[model samples]
Target: MTATESARPGKRGGTGRGTGTGAEAPRLAGVPLLGSLLDLTSDSLGTYLRARGEHGDVVRITAGPPGLRTELHCVFSAEGVQQVLASQAANFRKDNAVYQEVRDSFGNGLLTSQDEDYLRQRRLVQPLFTKRRVDGYAGAVAAETASTLAGWDRAPDGVVDVSDAMMELALRAVARILFGTDVDTTVDVVDRCFPVITRYVLRRGYSPANFPRSWPTPGNRRAAAALDELYGVCDEIIARRRRDLAATGATGATGSGTDTDTGATTAAAAGTAPGAVTAPGAAPGEDLLSLLAAATSADDAEFDDTELREQVLIFLLAGHETTATSLSFSLHLLARHPELQDRARAEIAAVLGGRTPGAADLDRLPYLTQVLKEAMRLYPAAPVMGRRSVDAAEIDGHAVPAGADVILAPWVTHRHPRYWPDPERFDPDRFTPEAEAARPRYAWFPFGGGPRACIGQHFSMLESVIALAMILREYTFEAVDTEIAVSAGITLTTTGPARCRIRRVDA
Candidate 1:
């Protein structure tokens, strides 16, 4: 069957279970004992693609040596994705080995939390990401983007590592918006340790060997050290924010003297120590840290310091890393396709007339938004979402046994020919209202879907759009490498530094 025909929502064509028909899913045969773990560790995206190609949308992949101790049901079809992420989400949960790995580092933060705790934390955090709250962050996003570009201008070489640059920019942006304090001490520590921790965790998670994090293994030690540093940083930031709130007698609510009615931080409350680049109009309580610190659940249950640290650390890491990856990939794509870059630049120029973009300008920059959407479609930041079946569940009429790992891969679904034609092409127009309206909801879920979807989705999109506009406004990027190579871990990122030659655009 053709890729197009096979990818249809309910089409069944492979050596696997019949789509929409009750049948046992086909299992991939691998070497005795190891199963497909080696293939997965080496090239996860390639493995999934090959599995879906050969075994159909839903395939059972066994892992573990000889005993086949673990089985993962890889779901590629939109129908199956909806089943796992939405329709039958109650039957799937985050308490799986994959999330346990995340929890080992992040604790019971929103991403790794399950059940009642998840719902309570979600409610407490949801208000902070509302459209109004996210818009308040636009100034910091633009300021940091412009500041980073200025530094690049003074660099000895015109060549820049787009990946590192984006990561730093995103880190600073998120720090400024979330911390509202001179978190340089914390940011510096996080910047140094974040990569080490993520890389170590990814390797351990994918490895067939289930090494206990408590083990004295070299990788575990390094990851533990990084986690310690991160925890220390979170502690310092939380303590400082508490001190600031106490000094001002602000409960972090409106009219608290630390923040305006709009929740913008006051200069004194913003913790602008010498050399600190504070976000203008920001207040002490305006940031997420302060809000979280002062927040209470419906029952008035407050988060203790450790819980607070977990949430803050997770946000700092997740907020920056995911957006940075997306921005790097977006820049790489634009550099590779100069025509699209020019078109995006033209749209930015027409909309802002060279002024730095603000949250208000976002609605007007449809093409730039489309460019970002398209880039994410091609290289989704969170390539795969995993859940464990709480009980036996039916996905596309195929029975998924309890305790099985349910994998929904955006990387595969986004490129499925039934949902996206000429899927490999860089076509921003594919995100046009008409085209998007024509596809199923799960066809391109870069930010995921359902109640458990990314809480920072709005924040991420706004930050990326602002950053892309600011960068494109100031510079025209030229690809220095013939090809851009990417690697997937906790998030999808470029394998190495994405090198690009930067040229200042004429005003």
Candidate 2:
């Protein structure tokens, strides 16, 4: 029963055990040794749905090592999500064991850190998403999209894997803006370790305990090797920039890779900035790396080079993968629904009018925005968010022991029929401002909620819109086959691969 409904003093001893709801109380079966394990591992959403249906919204099921009870509440209810995220947020902490399982490779950047460290880092990094700062990123987003589109082959009946296409676009966009490097060149450098990282993070059997480091699993070894290479690359770039800036006598980490006399280029790599660069109309450039390097915490906390690399690596891994999944799934939906695709394309064309999309265009492209929102609702990359109670407390009148894990799942919430109409269908209109207003605040969270909300949210959303607009403006896509099944691993992606046919559209 909801906490509010059961707040009255109970006449009986030790508070009432009776369910506030008129329905019979759920009974835990003594049999089925593997029931909870199977439920936790496979088809977790389905299991939650059934439990909610059988009992009420806040049903408890047997989970974890046998007899080790854990509270599995369905906060899909708007009120439930709010209470969990905002009302009692301080009571929650990111589920460490689960996050550690995923974040061990990336190190404790924003995504995995908690308490004072997380807050300090968040404060240092928050300004980068400010209107003035994000506005600066628009030109880069557009340039990357336009350049990526120029290389597309749209032959008659030519098929392209939209998912793969988006992966390429997002990785490159993030790389250029965040690290100031041509991502296309670095994709090979980083992607060599991508599969292994993904496997370790998402694989059901991924337990750090049993998996011996001695074993030469190629992916694991590759991932370790890749980390070394990534660190080396980051160090090299920092040293080069530091050297150039010193040569020019620049106060901060500014660029000096150019000759003022002849406007002669010194750095030969294509797309690399000449010592320093500026945005299309801005005075000077400040990429994510530079900004992080420049930031100083309120308490005088400063990030050294190692900390900087850790956060940047976190940005690369978390930011790129999630945005790619969102775009990929949205494209898959667009291909399936021709009417929706046409509507999105028309919206983009009308708003952009053949000129490149700008920050202003984002505000105008409501339909495109809705399409992305709905797509992310259906396929939230980080579907489940959890926290462990530091001290023993009652949650919705249930005694949640201090060590217990409290989970709030966006996947189940987005698909909760009570809130989402036709929960499983690909319906973009549901995300209209009017429609969204009818739902609860936490009902549609894709970047999660509370103090720990994904820091790269604005960046990701901006990237998705620009990328989609660019692709739709240049190509008309159709689902070559609608039967392709999508499965969830680390990210909600096609079980096999996302295949689509594209033809260049006439401007």
Candidate No. with top TM-score: 1
TM-score attained by model 2: 0.82
lDDT agreement with native, every candidate: 0.74, 0.62
Model 1, residue 16: displacement in angstroms?
A: 19
- TM-score per candidate: 0.89, 0.82
Query: Tens digits of per-residue lDDT for model 1 on 379-493?
Result: 8888777776767767886877766667788889888988888899989999999989989999988877777778788889888998898789889988987477765667776
> What residue pairs are clashing in model 2?
255-275, 257-275
Residue-level lDDT of model 2, residues 1-507, one tens digit each, is 000001001111111232232332243232365435455556565565566556655554544444333334334455666766777788766554446544566677777777887877777666555544565566666676776676677433588777777877777777777666534556676677666665655542223133553467875676667667767777766555455444654432212212111111222111223222223312122456655665554464557777777787777777777888888888888999989999999888777666666555667789999999998888777666665555555555445445444556677778888888788899998988899898788888777667666767777787788779878988888887676565445555556667888878883
Residue-pair clashes per candidate: 6, 2
Superposition TM-score, candidate 1 onto the true structure: 0.89
lDDT for residue 333 in candidate 1, whole number 0-100: 87
Off by over 4 Å in 1: 1-21, 208-211, 253-261, 264-278
The RMSD (Cα, Å) of candidate 1 is 6.3
RMSD of each: 6.3, 8.4
In angstroms, how far off is 436's CA in candidate 1? 0.6
